[model samples]
Target: MKIYTRTGDTGETGLFGGPRVRKDVLRVEAYGTADECNSAIGVARAAGPDPMLDAVLAEVQNQLFVVGADLASPNDSPYIPRVSATMTAFLEEQIDAMETELAPLQQFILPGGTTVAAYLHLARTICRRAERVVVSLAAEEAINPELLPYLNRLSDFLFVAARIANARAGVDDVPWRKP
Candidate 1:
């Protein structure tokens, strides 16, 4: 198949269930940001050879695809896999497990450390953006109710993952300080 579909050349794209929307619409923005977060995680995975982090992030990357697809499809679309509470629970479990390996945070931290950790921090912010967009979308229409909680927990997971990466590398988190 040719890579160029040219269908979106006019600033519109089709949803999974035969609906067309402007490329700039909220749903598109939400899924696009989710895709961006997934790519950022991939970069973090490639930035270093941390097997545990890579394994966890690999699962997250796949889950993000489900997120993107859930956002891309209409609420009633039966073919798409909807985001679920179980997915969010998994992230919660991961965050709890990783947090146990590091010292408790007493102050705010900046988004920089080892390369892998730094990339994870970046992914965390992108995930936040995706979550915000999804929230906005949900306000206007019906969405998979579990999406918000999943994205919320996913960001928390990313934050702890970044810290774990830094800790495992013997790098300290860059703490925020008053100017």
Candidate 2:
């Protein structure tokens, strides 16, 4: 199969169920941002985090693929698996576990520390953008209601994971300070 399909040259892309939406549409933007977040996570994983963090990131990367697939497929399609309460629950568990290992946060954190931490923070922001776009899309149409909660929890997971990465490496989180 040739890589260059040229099908989207007209700024239109196909969703899994049928209708072709404009490339710039909210649905497409939401999934595309998810893809971008996956790539950022890949970059962070490649930077060699601790074994546990690396494993968590690997799982999260797979889940992000599921997220992107869920976004790309039409809501009514039965062929695709949508995000579910189980998925979000697993993230919540991970977040809770990570929190137990770190000190309580007394202040807001800035997005910087170790390289892996920085990348995770960057991915968190991208996940937030994806979440926002998905929320906007949901407002305009029917959606797989679980998606919003999954993305919301995923961002929370990313934030804590980044902190854990920094803590494991003996790097302190850069806290925000009023100038």
All models, RMSD in angstroms: 0.9, 1.0
User: What TM-score would every model get versus the actual structure?
Assistant: 0.97, 0.96
* Clashing pairs counted in every model: 0, 0
- Across 18-122, the per-residue lDDT of candidate 1 in tens digits comes to 589999999999999999999999999999838987898999999999999999998576788888998999899999999999999999999999999999999
1-179 in candidate 2: lDDT tens per residue?
A: 99989999999999988689899988889999999999999999998899999998999899988888888987467788778899999999999999999999999999999999999999999999999999999998777889999999999999999999999999999999989
Lowest-scoring 10 consecutive residues by lDDT in candidate 2? 74-83
Off by over 4 Å in 1: none
TM-score of 1: 0.97
- Model 2 alpha-carbon drift over 4 Å, by segment: none
The number of clashing residue pairs in model 1 is 0
Error of 2 at 45 (Å): 0.6
